[model samples]
Target: MPHDHQNDEPLSSSGHPFRADDDTKLSYWQVMEIAVRELLIEKGHISASQVHEQINRMDARSPANGATIVARAWTDPQFKAALLTNAGQTSRDMGFDIGPMQLIVVENTNSVHNVVVCTLCSCYPRNLLGLPPDWYKSRAYRSRTVVEPRKVLSEFGVEIAPDVQVRVHDSTADMRYLVLPAKPAEANGVSETLLANWVTRDSMIGVGLPRAPV
Candidate 1:
């Protein structure tokens, strides 16, 4: 039988008495996940070391992986063809794992610009491009990008010409996307290593363009 604690005060993690009305803002599922994980750890059902190792693996991934691939594509037309044809295999060939999901690489051309968004949730190419940024997972960005892509791009300081068309791609659980930003004219003679510096996470997401070499 449970004791009645209607009149008893609740304490936070810090042992400070807290009001029940305090807003932690965590969802029911999120709170439950934390509770379950803690309980499992306490019971020795799962090792904390295993959890930390997985976390470290995730943290190891970064935007530089995607930048290298983009730079290679810019320099090697044959590699570009292979990447466009099969991004997952191409990524594997380059020592990156894109998981089981299919990766679709969209090329930005003179006539068109492409942007990617996941309206439901942030289904990004995390294995290749690291974690998604905060704004990429926001509701405003997910909703507005599809509706008014040009306006969204403008907010990111990307101004497309009036004649160019803006195409927005919705990523899903089964498929992910990466934008192949057009190589800057000035980057023609740039070395692959140096060109990789021009590719940014936002540019790969299609929110912004790559920085021009100074």
Candidate 2:
């Protein structure tokens, strides 16, 4: 029932591909953003250099930043506590510009797993995880994840034990979430950089597990 194709496009018509933020055809909102930015620049309210720097900063953000945080949490209890208590501030303390977005971190324990979804739209913590995968924005994923989480996660190759609970968190424009994956047993005493390598984007999204140490 969660996934209904009632609103699907006609099979006779091929749908347009997903458009990138910088695609040739701009959305109304995208055009507005550009216009507002340029107006601010022309009015001396902001500088082009500052705009470029901000764009570069956003472009530089990736899952790597989140991996670093998870790795540190695995190695340092105090930081992990801080991260769980106040993710937005902790991320800022780690030098990530999360802007005005409110971030909430959920922990994956032996008895429970946390998954993220945006039933209404594709709201995500892009500041920490960069661009979302194309599949994440699909109607099926958005609708079915909340209804049949176990089946959905299994499709991603994640097997959750029957005894374990699956909790789905819905993201919104003002609030976002990140999953703090459980640390691997073999990761003890591993360097943060090496541990970071085990953290994948899907793991942070709760669709996959951390890679085993190799």
Candidate 3:
């Protein structure tokens, strides 16, 4: 006997199967965000176009932007000094939209290597480096990076010498960190653009070294 299975499958208005996005309901905060934005627009406190533009600007930021900053710091001593002194101001001066978040730039040297992690949550430098990687937000990374940083780093293929110290910095909601990996020797005379390409996100996170210029 043929079964009447038509009702078992859920379909959209146009007779297509519903997508995962359609099946899932909006989250509480998501609904609240929409309501707040709409209310602000209704009260003329903010314009929709302004909101759109801001979203676009945030979406445009990525690791490439941070890489460019790193490249500039590598080539220019003054810029490097300024960056090390005041990371947030230096980034804003360079036209990055880091908002009001406090950014700390740690430099990797011959004797010290710095790594950043958010044990409580994923407090990342997203405005400059885009979204944090999955591992960065994982429990293992958050907890292990603080406890056994050297072993965690080793798993990522970054082996620090016994004599060299590994320093771990915990990122908070108000403060974020960016690791300035020691510039590769091969990148000494490279152009800023080329240098930027060699500066990987993992390098900036202190999990790996900058790619050698080929």
TM-scores for candidates 1 onward, in order:
0.81, 0.80, 0.84
* lDDT for position 154 in model 1: 89
* Structure candidate 1, residue pairs in collision: none
Residues 88-138, model 3: lDDT tens digits: 999999998788878889999999999999999999999888888999999
lDDT for 198 in candidate 3 is: 94
RMSD, one per candidate, in order: 9.2, 7.6, 6.1
* Tens digit per residue, CA lDDT, model 2, 1-214: 4333466444323444333456478889999999999999999999999989988888888999899999999999999999999999999999988888799999999999999999999988998888899999999999999999999999999999999999999885678999999998877788988999999999999999999746
Per-model tally of clashing residue pairs: 0, 0, 0
As a TM-score, model 2 comes out at 0.80
lDDT of each prediction vs. the true structure?
A: 0.89, 0.90, 0.90
